[model samples]
Target: EAKEYAIYIGKMGKVGLMILLVTITSVVCQKSRDWHVGVDTVNPSGTVVHGHANIPLHRGDDGNLNANVHGSRVFGGPYNREQTVGGGLQYEHNSGLHGGLDATNMRGYGTRYSATVGGSRRLGPGTFSIDGGASRLPGSSRTEGNVWATYSVP
Candidate 1:
């Protein structure tokens, strides 16, 4: 009987905490000129998180320089979807040039910091992107630079 009472008390405590926090996260969403989005975070991903910022740059009615950011930290072990994996900074300019660089801090165990720089150019009917950056921590470092090309679908 005593053991049962203790177990019940512990269970109640956890339930009370979840109820309090869940109330504040009942809804997660974002909206844009051509898109409206919503995410139900109470389930698998745990919390619907997203970005809907207007972006900081643009070239013209048909040209654009947009930036974006997103993040999530989940719970549980096997599904331990919870670990500090990677972070990065990116840049883009009008004329179809898009580039990004990222770093994985303690990718699976601890913490880290990273940085990146990139540029892009346009070719006859096609666009090219070039990126260079590196990540470093207490005793480890990963450096990389690359160029990729792609043409429009139409």
Candidate 2:
């Protein structure tokens, strides 16, 4: 029957399109590297380096494809103090799926590792985000979370 044939062709077409999209996304993620650098002053002085990749996986044109890897070195200034090294991965999809893992050294203290999951959506002139995760540090482990909003006025 023509109806059956058409249905079969439609299913195949969808499958083929999905395969193509996945291949293209893999290639783009492999090739794209947008590097960024910054300084953090929360504890003495620290250097932060971040690299990002964009994948075309957004349903809305206003959203972004984000994947980032970052590292930081915190050193005491003008005095000898605890020095630490930290690194993490940050990923956020336009479809509101976000999560990452982070690890850090605490000088004389043991290392800490944590994982976070969160979601964000556009709010009035800003974005609202909430996330929670647990950290394993030295002799103990703890969990925490917070709700935050950011706004950029153009």
Candidate 3:
């Protein structure tokens, strides 16, 4: 029941259209799994035709393809336009302190394909995270980590 689309203007100086078909599914021992699908279209002139949807799925494994966010910014455009896809899995067990590791393949003009792994923990009101990724993009291939703590005087 959700629909969304987008449009853009570039130096292409022409008209083109791209369509998208999306499907979301969950594996829960072959019972009570959820699935949904939709279509989107974009014009050749970097214009969005307007048509998008977000299929709801049950989160049991929490490690699936394209299952991170229910909504996307580029639903009507080509999948190749996406910056990152697949290879990243996340799992958080606790609220006060939780971390997730991720690996993703980068695409597009300045994106390199590489697997990345990073984790972060949140302590009270402060959170710390580290990211080390090797990709085709400039300024995006290094190992880094940080810790931040905040205190409140009541």
Candidate 4:
């Protein structure tokens, strides 16, 4: 009789766990989606703090759009101290098109700027894409650019 009681208790424990999981899943699924924010702090000899956020601009059947912003600060390091802030906008479409523009500035350093554009489409039995970008680094007079094409089939 003790062996039977032990078996019944094990089954009951499993059933209780299953019910808890279902309740948690339902609560999570019913929550609304929104923007995201995050922060990081580390202190190993030196100290560093970073924060970022993602704001949703639009969401539809075609695609989605979002804006991102971030900043970082360093203290008590060999380099003394430094800080940087930047933000960018990104977009996507159902037609296989995407692009983004970004810029950042660092204290005691010049600002850097960059932009990227790319698109992909069906070509015969495969897909073809062309991506290109250009950027000018901080405190640099020369601008760098690159372009490439890719084809893939599966």
Write candidate 4's Cα lDDT for 1-154 as tens digits.
2223323444354344334433443454334343232323345543444555566778899987877766655544454357788988888888999888888888888788989899989999999999999999998998999998999997
**Model number with the top TM-score:** 4
1 or 2, which is superior by lDDT? Answer: 2
Candidate 2 regions with alpha-carbon error over 4 angstroms: 1-81, 145-154
Worst 10 residues of 2 by lDDT: 46-55
CA lDDT of every candidate: 0.41, 0.51, 0.35, 0.66
RMSD of 1: 9.5
lDDT of 1 by residue, 1-154 (tens): 2223323444354344344333323332132232122323445434322222233344465445444333333333243344333444445555444455454544355555555555556657765555555555635566433444445433
Q: Where does candidate 1 stray beyond 4 Å?
A: 1-68, 77-81, 85-89, 95-108, 137-154
How far does residue 94 in candidate 1 sit from its true spot (Å)?
3.6
How many clashes in each structure?
Answer: 1, 0, 8, 0
lDDT tens digits by residue: candidate 2, 1-154: 2223323444354344334434443554665544433334443542222222333334354444444433333323443234455666666676666777777776677777888887776778766666666667766756554544444443
Per residue, candidate 3 scores C-alpha lDDT tens digits across 41-124 of 445422222222222333444432222322222322354244334323344433333333443344443423343444555547
For model 4, state the Cα shift of residue 69 in Å: 0.2
C-alpha lDDT of residue 29 in model 4: 37
The worst-scoring run of ten residues by lDDT in candidate 3 lies at: 20-29
RMSD of 2: 18.1
Count of clashes in candidate 2: 0
TM-score versus the correct structure, for each prediction:
0.41, 0.46, 0.31, 0.59
lDDT score, residue 59, model 4? 86
